[model samples]
Target: MIQAMYKRTKIGCEVLIQQAIDECPISTIKLYISRYYKKNNQRWALWARQHSPLLLQVTSTNSLESYHSELKRTTSSHYGLIGACHKVVALDQKQRTDSEYVAFEFRTKKISVMGLDDEILNEFHKFPYPIQRMLADEICAVENRIEKGKAIPGLTSLHCNCLFFIRYLLPCHHIFHEQIYGPTKLLTTNSWRNFQLMFEESGFEVYFHNELIEVDILEQTKAEKAAEN
Candidate 1:
């Protein structure tokens, strides 16, 4: 129950914690919940307002720490300054290439919704490609449930009861199920779309700036050589 609570947003956590307080049989568990969760709830719980869409899938900082470890590994006693610099550049390029490839695949590849019922799949198709992939994953994870409630009306007022949709602003399995009953527009304000937009807007500027700098440096070097001659 505690672990489940940790995965929920602050509002959801409060609801679950209250349920635990009212129904939990174990005295020690109730005591711990009352003391730690009830008294100092906001300090520990992940509030929806504070959460970032990019980090909704992230559980810990271990991945970042691992990347730092790998970066440190690129430099050692065996490597000179130039060798370390070259290795760093190579690693950076490889990472950038991998990122571009992934983005390209995301943009180009057709998402298969083979198992989904025709109605549901048709609604799913109305979304953008990135959203389709995300919804597909969510739909696969949905278990059997007697769905209750009406579909939300519009993008501005859209919401899903599930934590993923609440925290990340992506439609969850429940929302998709709701969509079957009544169609709702999928909003595209989440981090994934933002990243795609940002890249599309700024990707060329860096290369253009770099080429200009290189040309200026070459011109300066040539002028210095001519003066010496």
Candidate 2:
């Protein structure tokens, strides 16, 4: 008889298993889901269950410091250190005060503000909530319209190229005009770009203004033709 010697050792490897539920116990919480299937020759009733994790697997190493640091990188180039600092201060002020408007302007040269007064009054009927709600809704609506290839109506200017401040801090227009502007020019493109670059370098994303182009329902232009093709 031959003698055998064995040594224990730890081993690990990632494995993907088929019909994964077989490896684990199902919870008693029975959920009903609707599924549709095509009809085939044989008449049969089938029951199948599947489990999908709702929350993604999160590794909790990243922190706020890392995030802010990333943002600082993008913004520093566009806005100098001082201008960037001012924007941060202005943003904080806006958040605290809760009165701010974004830079928006009419895309069409001939566009008239005929219904603007009524819209403004109707939307901001309440003392505090209306204005807030209007801003929130308008932002969402404009984003949606842009995504859906629809026209975004009405535009408001952001004093100067202070789009960075508006995008980041969401300050009220009154404070921006009174506090931020200087010597006729409120903010310049270079200043805004630098500030925006700093934010970008610091790991923040910039959302530029929406493109102003009307889609003709009746006429199919060359650009539209190429897209369809």
lDDT of 2: 0.32
Residue-level lDDT of model 1, residues 46-106, one tens digit each, is 5532344443444468956875687787777799989988988887887789878877665
TM-score of each: 0.52, 0.16
Q: What is the overall TM-score of model 1 with all chains considered together?
A: 0.52
Candidate 2 lDDT over residue span 1-229, tens digit each: 0000010111100111112223435433111101111121011111110011111111133654654564565356679779888866765575445423321111111222233344333323311332244334443343455577654222234432222223333323332333232233333444334433432332222222212255777576776888999
Output the number of the TM-score-best candidate: 1
Off by over 4 Å in 1: 1-44, 48-59, 118-130, 141-143, 146-157, 181-229
The candidate that achieves the highest lDDT relative to the unseen native structure: 1
